[model samples]
Target: MGADGGTASALEQALSTYLAHLRVERGLSANTLAAYRRDLERYLAHLVASGRRRAEDVTAEDLSAFVTNLRTGDDGGRPLSPASTARSVAAVRGFHRFCSAEDGTPDPAVDLRGPSQARRLPKAISTSEVERLLDASSIGDGAVPLRDRALLELLYSTGARISEAVNLSVDDVDLEVGAVRLLGKGSKERVVPVGSFARRAVDAYLVRARPELAARGRGTPRIFLNTRGAPLSRQSAWAVLRVAAERAGLPHEISPHTLRHSFATHLLAGGADVRVVQELLGHASVTTTQIYTLVTPDTLREVYASAHPRAHD
Candidate 1:
């Protein structure tokens, strides 16, 4: 009930209950929960090392030490980057808050602050550039071209990560309903609406291409396949996309997340709700999707500078 109730076993039990709360009440995905667990593991290690065994026994000084430990390194010479340290500190903070709220344990991490993270704005391709990429992918006429075209279109349209696109099965796509089910990180599955362009491309690939590829691969259920007929690996998908990007004259350094980034940015620029984009992008937190909003202001400024009759040069 208080700091007087101090035991290492009590701390472990409290950590388990807090994690269960995160999973059930909070609906956090598995990967996110794993990260929380990983971060807390370090914090727990720090607690154990300092001989503070109970949630109530943790103090502001202990929380600060945990943050410092995260910044320095964990028994290893390798240092954690600022962002990684920040995430770890955040996990520790959340754990303390959970203990305080649920078990009425004192909250020592309440005033602790994680290191400031450098904001890495997502890079978004212009709409015209995306169009060029799609056109280039579909330009060549062959089974591979057809499949690549579908893949690229789907990526752009649905904002699916490459893994989601590759893991898709024939049944995951509902062309008639204009939707595609994406299996995202943490085993989360989301069904995003497919635009007409993506549907048409997918239809062409399915009708004229997928069967041929599948035949070679012993009836693999994956929607995208390599030349040898196996389910497309992330590496191969990246290579396929690189070829399309080169043909479209896109930058050589363009990442696979480009289309996904562009999708969210464009939607936000077009006045889409942040919450809607969060659902589309399969983000567990709306705050995660809020990054795209940062990309919209430049676009808004461009619109204002170019349009409005009074702003003549």
Candidate 2:
């Protein structure tokens, strides 16, 4: 096929096929697929402009130049941050791998690397702040307030991701056993111990609030439901956390994962083993869980100043 039209169409077809594979076979979420589409589209444009119509025709140098263009804004777009650039690189790499396997195209992106980024520590609120956040969720009256409180409580107590929390069925929770079954990434299941505080709050929600909310819509097995009685979406779950953070007067930007971070951090601080924390967080690797093991500068300074005999000096 010629480089002008045929090659361009081939590249576009490849991208469409790859995206369908991601959606159907890989089971990527809609948000993730959208991001991949955006990044790969940019790459396809660059390749076509450079007269490299076929995936196999591209070289490692072409891939490297594309990375530079992304970082330097040479591709008629604003400069991308390191993190965004890395995500774009990943999309391109994955696309090339798919082409190599399916079409026998050479994968020029195999050795391509994005710029390195510093690893920021997970932000964990103090226990008192956590208490304040949880309390704030319960401030208002009625079923909604009760449901909000239980959502926040369950999230903090189990270290469940917002996706996992919202996806929970009523049967997934076993209050009698003080445990919850969380389905993590790759459909893996892990049962985490529930604290008494969370168990009680969830029980209250189940007993009073859920029944009232359930009456609003068709019957469903979901544990958390919206005001309209539909199953709670990930976006709604995030909104729930955001409203709670505002009411709690928290200074930092609190996302849904903040409670999960605090849950892991506090456990490690309280002498929980790294392996145990790994299982609780449903992290496939202990190294991924080890980030929480890092001692905060504030904690380090406090320990030093108080315990060191000559700290004042």
All candidates' TM-scores? 0.77, 0.88
Candidate 1 TM-score, C-alpha based = 0.77
Q: What TM-score does candidate 2 get on C-alpha atoms?
A: 0.88
Weakest 10 consecutive residues, lDDT, candidate 1?
A: 1-10
Best by TM-score: 2
Q: In candidate 2, which residue pairs get closer than 3 Å at backbone N, Cα or C atoms, i.e. clash?
A: none
Instruction: Give the per-residue lDDT of model 1 (tens digit) for 52-122.
Output: 86777888888877667667775442468898888887888888888888878678888888888778889
lDDT of 2 by residue, 239-309 (tens): 98898899989998998799999999998877678899999999999999988878454654676688899
Q: Name model 1 segments beyond 4 Å from true.
A: 1-30, 74-77, 135-142, 183-191, 218-221, 227-230, 246-249, 271-276, 283-290, 302-313
**Model 1 residue 94 CA deviation in Å:** 2.8
> Over 4 Å off in model 2, which ranges?
1-4, 103-105, 295-313
Clashing pairs in 1: none
